[model samples]
Target: MYESGEVAIPLKDRVFGRYLADDVKTTEGKVIMKNGEYISHEEIETIEKENITSVRIKSPITCGCVNGICAKAYGRDLAKGEPVNTGEAVGIIAAQSIGEPGTQLTMRTFHVGGVASSSAEKSNFESPSDGKIKIQNLRSVVNQAGSEIIINRTTELEIYDLNKKLVSTFRAPYGSTLLVKDKAEVKLNDLLLEWDPYTVPIVAEEIWHFRF
Candidate 1:
């Protein structure tokens, strides 16, 4: 989901720089303003804080540039007395959604790593905390791998709400077909069956029950 927020501009620290002149070779770029037209980086120290305006935040994507220098570069131009274009001042919030199975798995693994690292950082030889941390780390590792094992063993699956209830389930037999909503139809193979709702418990014994 996309959300909008506001970012308060700091007037005192505005400094701008121009894009490399050699990079703008296209005819369309000829009309665009070049560097040195606005405030220089050194002039940022002179501006007062009250001169700032509210900037809109449309998306929450991570900036690849070092220390958000891209934003700072543009802010400097605004401060240095350049005319503003409608979209020119607005930042593109490139939100990324992790929808694919592989990406989801990777995120889960990353979360587990974080937990394991925290557990290790507090480890002490004499304290029982070390043993507890080891147990927690082991559990996270099993939980991560258990999902794949469940998917491999089960033909169908479903996810329920907060209450322990069955929302939906799919059944798989040899050559049986499963249709995902508006996506694709997949045929069941000997290895495993397809499922719905896609939120089944990742327990070894429970998964064993689904294995054919």
Candidate 2:
């Protein structure tokens, strides 16, 4: 619980019979569940449909004092509590403070002595919107191992709508393995690239013009 008498819990961890500390609303500002209402299984399903990841629930008073004494001391309801401000990113802030230090310490220990270590990196691109991919300036070469490897380093992946209007553009990180072919249609959450993120990132400052 935070100082404001509320705790943010992830949707998956939320328990029934707990009261809400604030109004739960949809992305368009329509209220799904009002403040101080007890969470029910039906409410949980409704929240899931809206894609809400977390919610603030009222924190029960645990001052460990005599029943009426604590209520009088705090000058608030013994059962219900004050609403926590939704503007505060309490969940994200707490996670960074608690998780970053451990992650940094673990990353440092990955490279002990002279051995190269694999660092965590994003190895794939998931499509954010529905569109067709348009690949440009792509160049590759076959290695002695008979594997095709991208070498241009400056190739671009552009997303276009059915009307041929460009919607978004992305540049593949150097040495990334391409997954989708040019003019391939894609939908949301579709995989676009399977990058070699475990290896040291290769950078090329100049654009290449290959003739093959």
Using TM-score, give the best candidate's number. Answer: 2
Per-model TM-score versus the true fold: 0.16, 0.35
Instruction: List the pairs of residues colliding in candidate 2.
Output: none
In angstroms, the error of model 2 at 72 is 67
The true-versus-predicted C-alpha distance at residue 111 of model 1, in Å, is 6.5
Candidate 2 C-alpha RMSD relative to the actual structure = 15.1
| Candidate lDDT values, in order | 0.29, 0.62
Q: In terms of TM-score, how similar is model 2 to the real structure? A: 0.35
lDDT of candidate 2 over 1-212, digit per residue (tens): 11111123445454444667789988899998997676766777888889885677655363345432232223222234442333444446557787866786877754243422353346767776888999888886544554445676567788887777897766666566667788999998788765665575454435567799
TM-score between model 1 and native: 0.16
Instruction: For model 1, state the Cα shift of residue 150 in Å.
Output: 50
lDDT of 1 by residue, 5-30 (tens): 01123433322332222221223334
